[model samples]
Target: MTHSKRYQHRTIISFFTVLIVFILMAGGVQAGIEPSKVICRVETDRAILPAGDSQNVVLKITLDAPPSPAHIKRPLVNLALVLDQSGSMSGTKIQQAKAAAIEAAIEALTRLGLQDIFSVVVYDTNVHTIVPAQRAGNIQSIINTIQQIRAGGSTALFGGVSQGASEIRKKLESDYVHRIILLSDGLANVGPRMPEDLGRLGAALIKENISVTTVGVGTDYNEDLMTRLAQKSDGNTYFVESGFDLPRIFAAELGDVLNVVAKKVKVTITLSDNVEAINIIGREGRIRENQIEFYMNQLYGDQEKYALVEVNIPKSTSGSRIKIAQVDVTYENPFSRKPEKSTGISYASFSSDSGKVARSTNIEVIREYQLNLNALAQEKAIELSDQGKKKE
Candidate 1:
């Protein structure tokens, strides 16, 4: 071959190599950019309720983000697991619950690599601190302790919660997600105070910034009291039909709770007169001293999540009437706010009718169900008291 041809071939090869290197670098840069931020927005397009009438409305918001990345720092969790070891929770219920609690604790330890502090309280006629508030370093010991809980006596739901909350309060200085996980299968029957009085205690805990998540096991349990406790504390309430379903729910939910990226999430709503009533569902939005705060109970990864608010508007006349319900969500973010990645939601409604209007959501339904449960429990308490008097 000619020398000139050889030189030209070498030059061509060098240029191609440089081009390939550039392409590879570009690809790596693209791959290195973190995934898009996740955001959840829940709203209702139309909520119509009769004038001077009340109805329950449900607004279901779908969470569409991908699973959180594996390497992100999981939030610090100071958890108190309040288990109900009442006589009703014998056999399968107690066994399944213990297993599930173990699974959840292990998963949190392994997956998140979190410095978790946990307390286990099992209550029947009285509350027993199986594992006092302590850092969860030894997983096997915690699991073993949980497995040792056996069912006995009456239900002291209030005592269990109060004790659990007290334990959580000790860890308030850690800035961790302080929470009480209450599991119960029956109404309170042995506590010194009435179940309704527990609401006052729960509200006080909320003020102390301690949240409660209540889980109702089986159909006969008093879901009302459990739900109320959760709502008042700005936490979550769950229903488990059987023992077999306990582990998965506990693992998924406890992990999510521990993974909370933000705390003290506040949402404010300014409604126009055209909207008669508005209900914030799923999670209770509390009216604080000056501002409104929604205790965000779930973990969000790389994205913003939303709560559903349903508004009832008066029926429209010939002309359109516009009304705005501004929603402001404020949360603590560990990362600096990126203007390009801000998350929020704007919801509005309109009506021309002079009559009254009402609205509801899934949260509302749950809240009502909770109320009904409370009434039933109260009635049962009264009946039992009367029966005791008659026996005496």
Candidate 2:
């Protein structure tokens, strides 16, 4: 072969090599990653604080899914997709939802394999189980069943969720990540329609390690009811303004579900005597005395979960340092298939110079703190509006 031809061949090989590398890396915290790697950190928004009493401070506990190479086993997921087929979801809404459900099923089959389980449940005025809970193997069958879902009748939101939860309980196992993805666009007009009824059900399901994620389509759905159920069960919620967003949202949610690295995660932060934990912002938790406890149902391999504790820092002498937090984290490792725990402690320093305290602020932690505070304020605004006190 000629030298020029050989050089050209080598260049072609290098280009293909680079392309393959880029494609693999683009998956980004997704499935087929080493699942046991979780990095825990406890940090104060500012390592140095002004030397004063009852100063506002933020304590952050972060659980990060560490980056890793591909091809590793993750925990099995048992997902029950509860879809709404009400009269209001007759046009683009129903079609988009069906397509999204089919896409999600295909994605789940590709990632979840034979070890994981999936089912389909649809509801209007009456509840129906389209696909029974079973190991994920027949993607075609699930797709066909989902396509048959037609829009008609009023919405029995409570019955739909209750049925999905029942389906998940069929294969309830200690190691499986049990969850229900509820998609609805209308109000609950049937029996047991109140938000409190669904909230009570969510609370009950969580005791058995089941979470319900509520996706509200358009603005017609009761956001309060949806959010309440999700919050009580330690699940995420989403609001989509248009039907076109359903497919993307379902795919993204399924990706996260398949990439779970840790489950049954428990984080407990005990503050020092001199420090008082006021509340947990952005997420739900129990703040009692000096101890703050929260339960994170699942952690995805490509996401970072954190808790912001609004704290009160007591007066300290200048040039003195104080220990503020003792953080303990426990979770079931999906890769190792075993339980593990880790502990970390955070401290803060007092400075007489305001510039020193400003310089010591961790920008990332502070940004998160401010964002969560804004979210808390928005939540309060919504609550006030709902209570017939919008003028306030």
Candidate 3:
């Protein structure tokens, strides 16, 4: 080949090599900051009745996320702590719970800054106030009140919850993160309402923009009821098997509760005419009337927070589709609501092959596990009934 031709060929090869390098760099950048989607699971089970006439169906939804250090801030917290002073919590349980409450209050007072407001509500047959809505400066007094509490009488879990929620309702007007932290060891035995009725009451409180977090201390506690209460109120539920675990759980979560970055964050999806149905499963979605609402359950100090929602798409024959889900977040601004507006939006496209959007596996597992447990419980109940008949 001539020298000029050879030079031209070499130039072409270099051009293609440079193009490949540019493409590889672009791919790496895309991989580094890939968009994430949330997942939610729903599980159900059916059990035969004693007369073999009907079946009961139980449903559960589980929420989860990829493991990461949670971004936390000192929340403007208005907290009402409803402690169980029932007969079962008399000795060590009451002592440890009191110690945990004191530690939580002091930690919030010192670490969460002075903006945090704290309160204490202790209950046995009835709810009593230790410290009403007050600033962190009075945390020492609250701690002293916790120490003075003693366990007695039957458990009035429902009454305590209702009273705590009422106290939180008073603080709802303030631009604060309102919450009630309930610690219990048994089912409701003294309240006029049933557990389910109390759950509905808690759900109503959630509608008023208040959340309730429940902690079940010890194995005898009614875990199912506590879990449902948290779920209904858009709050978190924790199980403490021993006293040793109380301090850390309280310290970590109480800090997060008090210093919330956003309040009343909600997401709504608007589908095109072709789309049929949308289901959101996880800590994210709550169905309210015609629209589904998603709350930002946890917030790191930063302005940005993460949420996941799963959409089910029906197969379409048309090569093109137009469906949009808008994520709208409404957060309380410490300042003026007009100047510092409380809303945000993120868009998801159904056509994108990029795996930025997908279903959540944690939701699926939670649903299946709950369903299986429900089925097992029903079977055991039936077996016991048969055994009693045989003895007769």
Residue-level error in angstroms, candidate 1, position 361: 19
lDDT of each: 0.55, 0.73, 0.50
Give me the displacement of residue 68 in model 3, in angstroms.
16
Alpha carbon lDDT at 236, candidate 2:
80
Q: Between prediction 1 and prediction 2, which has the larger TM-score? A: 2
Query: Candidate 1 at residue 257, lDDT?
Result: 62
Pairs with steric clashes in candidate 3: 38-308, 39-360, 40-281, 41-363, 43-367, 71-300, 74-259, 75-258, 75-259, 75-260
**Per-residue error (Å), model 3, residue 369:** 14
Worst 10 residues of 3 by lDDT: 22-31
Writing each residue's lDDT as its tens digit, candidate 2 over 161-208 gives 999989998988646778898978789998787779989988998888
lDDT of 1 at 298: 41
- List, residue by residue over 1-392, the lDDT tens digit for candidate 1: 34433332232222222211221121001112233333545444333233333323333232333344444444466778787777666433333344444444444334443256777777889889887877645555555555555556898888888899878877877666777878777768886445467667778887776888877877878765777677678777789776556666565555456445555554555554555444544445654323333545344564445454455554544233343344454554422222212233434333334342233233543454455457658868977866747431
lDDT of 2: 0.73
165: Cα error in model 3, Å: 2.2
Better of 2 and 3 by lDDT: 2
- What are the root-mean-square deviations of the candidates from the true structure over C-alphas? 18.5, 11.6, 21.5
Give the C-alpha lDDT of model 3.
Answer: 0.50
Off by over 4 Å in 1: 1-71, 92-114, 192-195, 272-299, 302-323, 334-392
